[model samples]
Target: MKSAKQRFAGRYRAPGPKRSPLITPEGAAALKAELDDLWRNKRPVITQAVGEAAALGDRSENAEYIYGKKMLREMDSRILYLQRRLDRIKVVEGTPADPNRVYFGAWVTLVDDDDNERCYRIVGADELNPSSGFISIDSPLALALIGKQLDDRVELSDLDKGYEIIAIDYKSAAAE
Candidate 1:
C-alpha cells in the first residue's frame, strides 16, 4: 500500500480560511497566465529532466531525479489549486454605479485627524498588495471606508483612530 504522500503525490494541502471569491480582471488574468505557464512550459521541462535523471541510474540515490520529483509535486499542487480557484471566483470589472461612495475597486484618499493623508485601493483578498496600496475588501480599514462619501468622517474604535474621506475615485491616483 502507498503512503498518503505517495498516493497523493504531495498534492494534499491542509484546508485554509475560505477566501473571498471576488477578483479584479487584472488579478484573474495574472492567475490564469501563471497556471498556463506552469502546466504548459515549466512542468514539461521538469518532467523531461526527471526522466533523463531516472534513465541515468537508480532514482532513489539520484539527487537530480529526487529534486525534480519534489519540484513536480509542488507545482502539481499549485496547478490543482489554481484550477479550482479560477472556477469558483467571480471576476469584478468596471466602475461601480455610485463612484462617489467607496466600493470594490475604488481608490480612496483619507486624511487622519493629525492631517496625514493616505491612499488605498480596495481589492479582493487575492489582490492584496501593500506596496501597491491595494487592500483587501475584507480588511478592517476597507470595511470602514466602504459606502462612505467624500468628506465623511470615519472612526476606527479598535485603533482609536479617526479619518475623513478627502477624495474618492474608481481609478488609482494621488491624493488630492
Candidate 2:
C-alpha cells in the first residue's frame, strides 16, 4: 500500500500547455466567489471535523479522520489553484473596438446550410460552458469565426455543414 504522499504524487502535474489567460468579467467573478466560499465556509468546517476526528486516537483506522483529511487536501489544492489562476488571469470587459467583426466576448449568431441557427459566445478557455453556448476562443469553431465579419461563411473539416455568420453582438450580450 502506498503512503498518501506517494498515492497523490502523480495528481499534481500541471495540465498541458497554458492557453489564453483571458476571462470574462463574469467568469472571474464566479471564480472569485468559489474561492471565497471554499476559503471562508467550507475549509474551516472541514478543518474542524478533521481536528475532532484526529483527537479520537489512531488516525490510520479512523474513517472520519481519513475522509476529512482527504477533503481538506482537495480543498487546499483547489484554493491554491484558484488563487494562482486569479492572479494571472486578465478579466476582459466590454465590447471590442470592432463590433462588426467577431472578437473576444462577441455573441455570434450562425446559420447552418440547413438553416439551423445557433448562438455562441467566444470566451476564454476558463469560461467554457457548452450548454450555455460559451465556447473557448481557441476552439476550432471560434478560431474559424474570429475576425470574420457578419454574413461570412465558416468551413470546418469536422462539420458536415458550413456555418454562416448571421449576427455579431457584444454590447447587449448577457450571461445565461
Candidate 3:
C-alpha cells in the first residue's frame, strides 16, 4: 500500500483560495528558511529517532517507534509540499510599477462600518493564513479590495451576509 504522502503527491494543490503570482520576498524567504531547516535539521533528527526506535523491535507496542514514525512522515510530507510550492512561486521584491493599485504582497488596512479596523497582506495561496494576517488574493475581501484605493468603499453580498470595507491604507514595503 502507498504511504499517505505517496497517495497525496501530485493530487493536492495549496489548500487555500486562489492567489496572484506575486509573493513578498520576505514571505518567500521565510518559507525557504523553514523548508531548509526542516529538511536539513528536523528531518534528519526525526529519521534517526525513528530508526533507533524501530531497532528496538516490538514495533506495535513501542511508543517511540509509533510517535517517531508519525512525526517523520509529517516532516516528509511538509518537505514535499514546500518543494512543490517553491517551484511555482514568484517572489515580489518590491512594489510594482503602478503603486496606486492594490496587488499581491500589498499591505492593506480596512475599516468596517462600525469603525473596526483590520489589516491584511495579500499573499499566495500556499502562504495564506488568516491567523497570521495573510489573506489569499482570491478571497472575497481581497478580490473586493484589489485596485481600490484609500477612502473607497466596497460592498459585497453573499447568500447569508452583506459586508462593506472602506480602504484606509495600502502600501508595499518598497513604498515605506
Candidate that would win on lDDT: 2
Lowest-sum lDDT 10-residue window in model 1 = 167-176
RMSD each, Å: 5.0, 4.0, 5.3
TM-score of 3: 0.76
**lDDT tens digits, residue span 1-176, model 3:** 99999999988887764446666677788889999999998988988998999999999999999999899888889999889878888886766667666777777777666677787888776678899788987788878878876567767675343234444334544453
Report lDDT per candidate.
0.89, 0.91, 0.76
TM-scores of the models, in the order given: 0.85, 0.88, 0.76
Q: How many residue pairs clash (N, CA or C atoms closer than 3 angstroms) in each of the candidate models, in the order given? A: 0, 0, 0
Model with the higher lDDT, candidate 2 or 3: 2
Decoy 1 TM-score against native: 0.85
Clashing pairs in 2: none
C-alpha lDDT of residue 129 in model 3: 87
After TM-score superposition, what is the CA distance of residue 105 in candidate 2 from its true location, in Å? Answer: 0.5
Q: Give residue 66's error in model 2 in angstroms.
A: 0.5
Expressed as tens digits, the lDDT of each residue in 1-176 for candidate 1 is 98887999778888877778888888888899999999999999999999999999988899999999999999999999999999998988888888899888888888998999898888888889999889998888998998999999999999999999999987652221
